[model samples]
Target: MSDPELATRLGAMIRDVPGYPQPGVVFKDITPLLADHDGFTAVVQALADAGRDDAGRPVVDKVVGMEARGFILAAPVALALGAGFVPVRKAGKLPRETHAVGYALEYGEATLEIHQDAIAPGERVLVVDDVLATGGTLAATRQLVAACGGTVVAAAVLMELAFLPGREAAGDLPLTALLVVDGA
Candidate 1:
């Protein structure tokens, strides 16, 4: 059950900017869609649906949003699913004791951190992000959740760059992407 019109609308709003932050990289900018009331609402609802079961019951105890863009989508999703929101931040951004994981990006290596007490033992987690590219961030986030004794049930993204090997990097973790772009 997918909405064609919504897909069309959302797809149109995503602008492709060539060579952003680095050469040979086309950034999928989602600002236009976020600025629109209806589009934003629809996208949030769509992403939140990933945290539910087939019978429409919320199945996650926490919704984890990665650094920067992920925070924008995951906060509302957490509210929609009636779950707690946890932030997987960049190194040193968090004040308290945290568990850290270093990951390789397309350009360089980076580390992410989460508070030691962010999630109670055995909490179910759903990771949300703006885009799925190399999948390094998602993998590192998964490790962070595991350190907190939480399990990542699935992941949701607004867009997926199919040219990259993100799906493989995710391994067996379920991933739902609203729009799939075949190329960079």
Candidate 2:
């Protein structure tokens, strides 16, 4: 399918739950899309293309997926890009030495950690996730990649919240999303 059709299909699969984890917040749930093989593959392929160079060759050395849902989306993207997959998880989840970064949330603070040895110095990395909301998680993931001495080439996501400041929060890092929706 074309990009517009792909976006439409993906959007159709997302179910909105009002006031989910907290009141007055609508969570865009992706469980429905995850269950459909075709939908899932399309997302992976679309995201994987973000790591390619101008000539259509893979340019990333590693693909870092931010915890939880991110892990699910990024692994296959890494394979498609011919890069290694790394996980940026919540603090204390990794057993080995890690580089952690703390970021602010709408209400509080949180930390994300990545294995210290995950990336070699100067390696080009592409960070991937299921969604880009406030961008705190993504920025923290960028920090973790830098701490490991890797250069973040770009950030990819299934979707991004246009109402939030995710792009600004991510600084100069290029971010590509399959869909950009207002709010949740």
Candidate 3:
């Protein structure tokens, strides 16, 4: 389906919660969409399509998903694309050698780590996350991928908090999101 149409449908499935985890934070909850098989399928398909390889094959060697929400979507996209799934998680979560990168968030600084062997040299990777808020998490994920000698093919998300400067911080990377919120 076209981006706009797909976005409309996906947007309909998202629930908005005010003051979640903090005051003045309007959280865009995605549980409703995750529970709907068709809605989830459409979202995963769209993300997988966005991360397609150049030869039209599932070119990504690894699908790198961020902590928490990212894993939900990335694993399915990895399976659909026939690629291996990797997770960039918080510190002390993985029981293996890891490489970490720090980035700035709205409130403070945060760090993300990926297994050192997650990606080998020249491996193509696609990073997936549920929401792109401040770009800090995604940017750090990109750096972690590079540290593992992986080439980031693209970064895809279910939604983008466009009010934040995530796109600009993401630089020239191929960033694709199913839905974008202008002010949320």
The candidate scoring highest on TM-score is 1
Backbone clash total, candidate 3: 0
Which parts of model 3 have CA positions greater than 4 angstroms off? 53-55
- What lDDT would candidate 2 get against the real structure? 0.89
| Model 3 Cα lDDT, one tens digit per residue, 1-184 | 7889999998899999988868888888899999999889999998998678556678788899998999999999999999999988888899999999989875568889998998999999999999988899988998999998889988899999999988888899999989999976
- What's model 3's lDDT at 135? 92
TM-score, predicted candidate 1 vs. hidden true structure: 0.97
RMSD (Cα, Å) of model 1: 1.1
Candidate 1 residue pairs in backbone clash: none
TM-score of each: 0.97, 0.96, 0.95
Better of 1 and 2 by lDDT: 1
lDDT per residue as tens, model 1, 100-164: 99998766799999999999999999999999988899999999999999999999999888888
